[model samples]
Target: MSYLDPETSKKLVPIGRFMGEHFTGGNWTELGFLTGCDSIVQNHPRLLRSLSFGDDDYPEACLAVVGSMVRNDPDNLKLIEDYIIEHFSESGPNISTIPGLGPTIRFSPTVFKVPTHPQDAKLVAVMMPFGPSFAGVYEAIKSACSQTQWFYAQRADDIWKDTTIIQDVFDLIFRSQIVVCDYTGRNPNVFYEAGIAHTLGKTVIPITQNSADVPSDVMHHRYLTYLNNGEGLNHLTLTLAQRLRTLDPTLAQFA
Candidate 1:
């Protein structure tokens, strides 16, 4: 039960408290236990270091424990899964959930430096590729956000094998200020990328050709609905430009 060192335990104390407050229904004792669990699973330096070094033994061991627990007690397993998924799914729980936990700690696997040059830095990252269906929308975004450098995953060179595509996407999203996610065709990849942006607390602008494409959980948020035709592109450009200006007035000059 006592698997984490002192330092790691200290780091996860806030996460446990936050989970306890928001997810445990005011169960202070449960909060303490969850905090300890969070420390072991998330803040353990040895486990994190092993993960960083591509070692899987520690994680596998943890998973084995979870598997055994599930076999031993299915009801308890459901409870554990529900708690973890409610607050720690997607990119995992972070300091943001706990008000006094200090500055946010980025847990992205690939740490990258933001561009120093003002012009070289990207402002908005468009997650959709430059395909025939999305080309007009892509161009419209560029025209609307002229001052912001936009990026697409397909623009990356194939120098790295296809296995690195997700990593490359993460690198790009991490470096950008905002992310534009188009949910056209119900593309699973786009949904995954949008989730990452949200978990990182990045400003995400969701756009879709059809309302049905937007996921149910995020349906409450504002999104741009557009057609894939000339008229639709024109309207989309105008609407997005207005949104950009509203979000950041400086972008109005470029629009």
Candidate 2:
């Protein structure tokens, strides 16, 4: 796609790569402000200086008032976010998986756009909980991975001691087509992240260990629940294969 400017590019595309994970956290409101501020200081230094107090009788009060106005003004935030979202493509996949998989079972999704043409097939992300629940779901994830080529990565935590990792996670989800969540533990962050992913129009795959962990809002939605054992692993794999068939016809071969 053609872009009119760098700002437009940042707003339109899902974050593919980043300097690090230290610049995450906050809502769109905060991101817009930061981007705007950075753009101004970098591109319009003279205008930025003009806003500050130097050799003037009005004191720093004038600059402080403008700062307050920018802070309290809803329009400013809206403008930035609108711009960001406007140029962005509303397509891609989302996977919600737990963090840190050493010798234990691990899962990740890796996605890339089909360069020659566009298709409806999506890049899916998987989110799972830690501990025994993940052990139970490990085979299921492996099955899912085998069926498709999804973008994969371990969730970033602290990025050079600068930003929260989820900020980057949100950035990734923005470009995704669907989100798969493993709610076996009823993790607060997983639930919260799933909400955000849903709000952004990502299709959500809500999986749980049992009915107890499933939220009432999503209880009505069909989900995959597996027991903890070798039998459970086999069942989960089969169930996931079937689900994949329904999601994408190409997945039928794998099923």
Candidate 3:
């Protein structure tokens, strides 16, 4: 009943070992759930019940379980990588087993986040000080994104999730491919969010009402300056649309 060949399954050991070591915390079930290994978990209900895996006395436990999975279906390897490892880090691990993988797995910082999530290629998150004056500006940007018919834009205040507001903001930025940050008035919160976006390696488009409002350190980056009037908003919409189309290559066209 094995789908993956012996050699192929053997190559996945490093991946399993890496997962066992680094992905600790109550995450085993979430990992299985995210990867759609429901049947595999159901088959060994007792053994798979733990939220934490391979971090205790039996270190090879997770590897053993993953070995069982790949033999049933090699596709699980790619699923775990996509839904887990790559989502966990910007740097994607080589699927191919490398020499000293066991040691190299430790070289990576121990950052375990359960319930992995993927980036939204079409999500454009806007970072700006939430206020009445900025409301028009936000709408203008949203309109600009609508021109692409491919990007969906939203700001932090637009949605409140079950988690803390700050956590919600982190999740939003984490999943976004493009982030638009307004530095007008040099708002501290906006500045902090901009730093987060930059660190996450999102394509940050800086827009401000005045050139002088742009921060000193980030002056190297070009900022789109605009007026918030009816005519100015229209112009901002047109120019921003062009910039977005140029920046986002996730799609050629979307109906």
Candidate 4:
């Protein structure tokens, strides 16, 4: 049997019935059901409590149902959005929200605003000189996103034809609560941005693909190292995840 609430389960009835009729029906492992249990459960607890349908097991069951739909039907993006929004809000039994839900799955504007709750979180800025070399940038981004609201300001080329762009980049850096700088190439522009972020009192995370690439002056600062091969991406993810936990204990695990 499905683990979602009867109402939400109804939205998935067609698909479930179709699978039942054409495919051999199997069981949903309890452990698998909770794996993708919407991240919002931890983010918003009020909604979970409000939506609980009397039975104490309803919340977990609802979460498992939503997780199953999301994992099984990637193309049915609307359903996933509905699940996220529904869980994000503590609104009553009736509320008009997210017209086409899926399209609204993007980050909420409030997440960009200054954090009110200590855990509402700080903004993290990233300074990566050579974008192409940092495949782990994606994972690092995911790690940051999980821990705090962040914006990425990457310098594509050190030589900018228009100096005005430098100011724009500086604005992004200064607005950030923390700055992560990748010094894999000893790129001067990156060091410049790092110095600016440091002056502005933004926490700076200095990392390099190799320790040898670290600039002499910044060498005293601890740096994360990785091999340029595939393993580099994994190392970056794990290291960044650990560092992010230090930044925010609430995000000790993957968000």
- For all candidates, the clash counts are 0, 24, 0, 0
Regions of candidate 2 where Cα sits further than 4 Å from its true position? 1-122, 132-136, 148-162, 249-255
Candidate 2 minimal-lDDT segment of 10 residues = 16-25
Q: Tens-digit lDDT track for model 2 on 1-255?
A: 111233323322222111011122232225435545433333433322433433232223223322332344423423433333333324322122211111222223243222222222354556566565465475566566465554222322312222545655565554444566878768987897788666555667777777899889978888888776778878877776566555452332233
Q: Candidate 3 at residue 197, lDDT?
A: 74
Model 4: which residue pairs collide?
Answer: none
Give TM per candidate: 0.49, 0.46, 0.56, 0.44
Q: For model 2, what is the error of residue 121's alpha carbon versus the real structure, in angstroms, after optimal superposition?
A: 4.6
Best by TM-score: 3
- lDDT (tens digit, per residue) of candidate 3 on 1-255: 355554555656766667655654335667667656655655654344443342253335566667777655555655665655444654463222112233222223233122145667678899988888888999999999999888889887788763666666776787787889989898888898888777656778899988888889999998798898988888888988888887544332220
RMSD of each: 16.9, 16.9, 11.5, 15.3
Predicted candidate 4 versus true structure: per-residue lDDT over 14-129, tens digit per residue: 43333222221112222123344344333444334434434344444444444455445432324443333354434311111112222222322321232232211245666776
Question: What are the runs in model 4 whose C-alpha is more than 4 Å off?
Answer: 1-121, 135-139, 147-163, 249-255
> lDDT at 110 for candidate 4?
26
Where does candidate 4 have its weakest 10-residue lDDT segment?
A: 92-101
lDDT of 3: 0.68
Which window of ten consecutive residues has the lowest lDDT sum in model 1? Answer: 92-101
Name the better of 2 and 3 by lDDT: 3
